[model samples]
Target: MNNAGRDTRQSTRFMLLYALAAAGGATAYVPFLTVLLPVRVADLAGAQDIAWLAYVAFFGAIASSLSNIGFGWLSDITGNRRGWIACGMVLSCALLLCVTQVQDLTGLIAVIVVWQLCLNMMLAPLTAWAGDCVPDRQKGLLGGLLSFSPALGALAGVVVTHPGMASDDVRLMLVAAMVVGCVSPVLIMGAPRRFPELNQPSAIDQTPRKARDWAALTPAIRMWIARLLMQISEAALFAYLYFWFRSISPGFGDNDVARVFGLVLLVSVPFSLLCGRWVDRHNRPNLPLVVGAALSAVGLLTMAAAQDLVLAIAGYVLFGIASAIFLALHSAQTLRVLPRPEHRGRDLGIFNLTNTVPSLIMPGLTLAMVPLFGFSGLFVLLTALAVVAGLLLVALPRPK
Candidate 1:
């Protein structure tokens, strides 16, 4: 009983530290990628800014996808998650500083590709380390804790881009420093001995991961598809939200949309935390995802049905809240459905595809949908996708 009590405390502390690290990881890239990357491209590319931004995004996504898988497999083979993360952080920060020195677009792309490779070297393993440490019973709360990452990341962007301080090198320096600060504490501390040999760095998992072992992931596969669908919508809104709001009210400016966007994400924090606790307590994990998707579908529908500014904003608020929770909770639940502990890092890197693929798919999807049927048409299509995501989760077999 005494041992059990100690273990519980250790696990709780681990979750908190892990959550901080997750937020730090987001801080590393979110500000730079979202705000600074385009600014850099525009400064270098001159009049071809749009073309340059597209190329950078395309190459960056490809690099992010491939490197996440490669580095994750490396970590798995080496049987050390933390070591790789530390090395990756240092190298990526060095590369991040190098980002300030690039004078041409070609050089910028080259640097970004390498930086992305090193960045995922940290991210992929950091993600899998949580799976190694946290048990299924706590994944819901773990995910809830992780829900803070993106919000803080957005806030970090605001911080690095403050009007008073305005040097590209200085901004990059702040980002690199923030990454080190947020990720260092967890790296210094040791992993908890909460699970069976999970924390041990002994040997590679070289046994062939067979087809039969893969069969156990039917639910995970459903989750994969559902998450992809939800992300498609989220990515679309992420890309075109400003335009959509501007369409409703031509008076809407970038600052207006940015403020609204950040606020909506901030609001999701309490909802996700509360829902995460509820999910852990009830163990009906799929239900919340289903409900969140359905509500998001309604939100999209509301976007279509009410094109007026007030109703559109309300619709977006609902969609943003629901989508945020679904994404957060689904991330934790994905760990529960993974087949083998040994391959957790690699499989998670595969899951990381869902994050990057949308950028690829949504741009083409939005262009195809919006030109034909207008923003209303795109909203309706997104509504359909969100519904399908919900139904997929509904089909998942429940716990006995």
Candidate 2:
């Protein structure tokens, strides 16, 4: 094969590998955060695990948010994302084992805080690394591929938390092993130097720009806020979907809910990929987001109005697929608006705040809204948020 063909093949392979590693990164947290942490907190804190979980969550979010930006910038200076990722993978995986040693909520909190810090060390650079290698045209497909991460994360949670795992230590060990297994392939077999700058030599940029103030970079900021809004809705549903379902029907089991949740995730992967390819084919790049946001609004509306289990599930499926499309494609498209190649890590870190920030927002929002108007009211508010998020992109000035 010619050089050009080789580069194409390598690029394809790199995207696939990156997607796998990204999914692995999600596994680093989703399973533990969703399943094990809660169980551990309950075991330690007993009746107060809810409060303890909130404390761990609040502190953990702060730790992750700070570390993501900090390490992303560090990677920018070092030009060694892979090295940082490898180091992070090792350290964070070690921290997973530490979770097994914690005998109290306070100790668990400490381990979680530190683990979050180590986890984002891998996550931050791993996120920015894509823009450093892949060009804008292919970012859509990359985003489509990235949709796989959450699915795998959820699957990992299911696997390790299965009834067969009788002990917390065993579960934690399996999680660490899974994290290592999922993430190591990329570190071992590095992205081909087809895009040499993806492997830029160690160098420092002492100047970190005030990226927020730049007029030219305004679109990226808009995209960031838009994403944060949509994510808030996602976070809310994620935390409360079970209770919301129960409110509809007392007989709805966790397995039924899980199947519905899992099916939506499975369906969204292909839907997002199709939408990503559509955007790539046409120059109407923001069209999918606008359309996705509209559909998300409709989905949320459907759920709010749903009177039966069947209707509620249908509405949730719609919302799930639409929101997934918006988020997945929006992520890849954010790369287009980032003005600084050298600062890709830093800027992407800023963009990623949307992910962590929602956790901080959701608890307060849920408390204030759910009690007043119930889940239906909350869904209506989310519908409005999604609409506004879509509009932010719609009103954005087009690139000349």
Candidate 3:
């Protein structure tokens, strides 16, 4: 390639990076719009019963788990991600707006269910788009860029919900949604659709099942499963971190939660980006995945051991850093092993179940664990899970 052509290519890749980051940024608002709102939903729904939230969470998990494959399959056949992205955003935002008007459990449940479905529809295709263009070598960088978006979105959520700005919070969320809606078109217009070769099972394949088939578990698929397990450990903490903080240290408030989560994200962003750079430079993505998961396990254990809020915050920040590193590299590695590149949207959707399935199960598991294992026991269990996941990653054959 000519120097100018090479420079343009480099520029295009960087733009793609920022676009991915912005898409990640958009993902941040979901917690506020969905999971975080249930507190309000309890009051609005007149049930004041968290069980309803759990029910919604359970169903949402199912929808999220299924939508990945459903939309991914569609994206694979269509070869156009932008349309799905736009439709998902618009439908989800409308649902968010609709949910704000709900005033009962039935209404809340119905709206949330639909909203979750649409959000997943958007996310499945959007996430698959990441693997579509980027090669395995740059997956870590892409993962880092994708990882930071939630932090940015979290900040946006905080800004929109300033104390006494209740009237405007919904509006701000809508604005966030609108900003995300714009991302797909801009990405479509700018990024070149260079269709890379797909990794397909042979036409005359004698194997009983395709590796991507739900039943088949290749080394790479096993690695992805490990990544999913790690995410579940993280989700277990996420589902209950606020409740635990409140139970253990009620003096801390929402701002405290946001601040702690924000600090964690802040620490994580640099570490994640650096980990990605290290992976690209040295080709050692798995090492970081292993180390980061271990660190996170330690952090979780520390959180359980903490006697004061400061210690807990420290633990949270450490966990955040470790989780971020693992997520960035683990995702890149998973992208490398997908059974079908043409079906990235489909395969990634299925893989994302690892991420979403936990969200569904973790909350109930946390509640159940606390009664039996208590918080410390929960942490210990989480630590063990993380270790197992890390070891599984180590066991996977190094990708060529």
Write candidate 1's Cα lDDT for 128-226 as tens digits: 988888877777898788888877776777777766665889999998999898899899975665587554433435555565546577888899999
Worst 10 residues of 1 by lDDT: 197-206
Best by lDDT: 1
* TM-score for each candidate, following the candidate numbering: 0.88, 0.88, 0.88
lDDT of 3: 0.68
lDDT of 2 by residue, 1-400 (tens): 6987656433777788888899899888866776667667767887665556667877888898889989999999998899889889999999999987878778888998899899999999998888777766677788789888877776777777656544788887887888899889988886554566444433434555564347557888889999999999887777567567878997875445555766787788998888878776775678889998999999999999998999999999999889988888888888888877788788788887898888788877777887799889989999999999999999876543
Report the error of model 2 at residue 20, Å: 0.7
Against the reference, the lDDT scores of all candidates come to 0.83, 0.81, 0.68
Off by over 4 Å in 2: 1-10, 42-50, 196-213, 246-257, 397-400
- Which is better, 2 or 3, measured by lDDT? 2
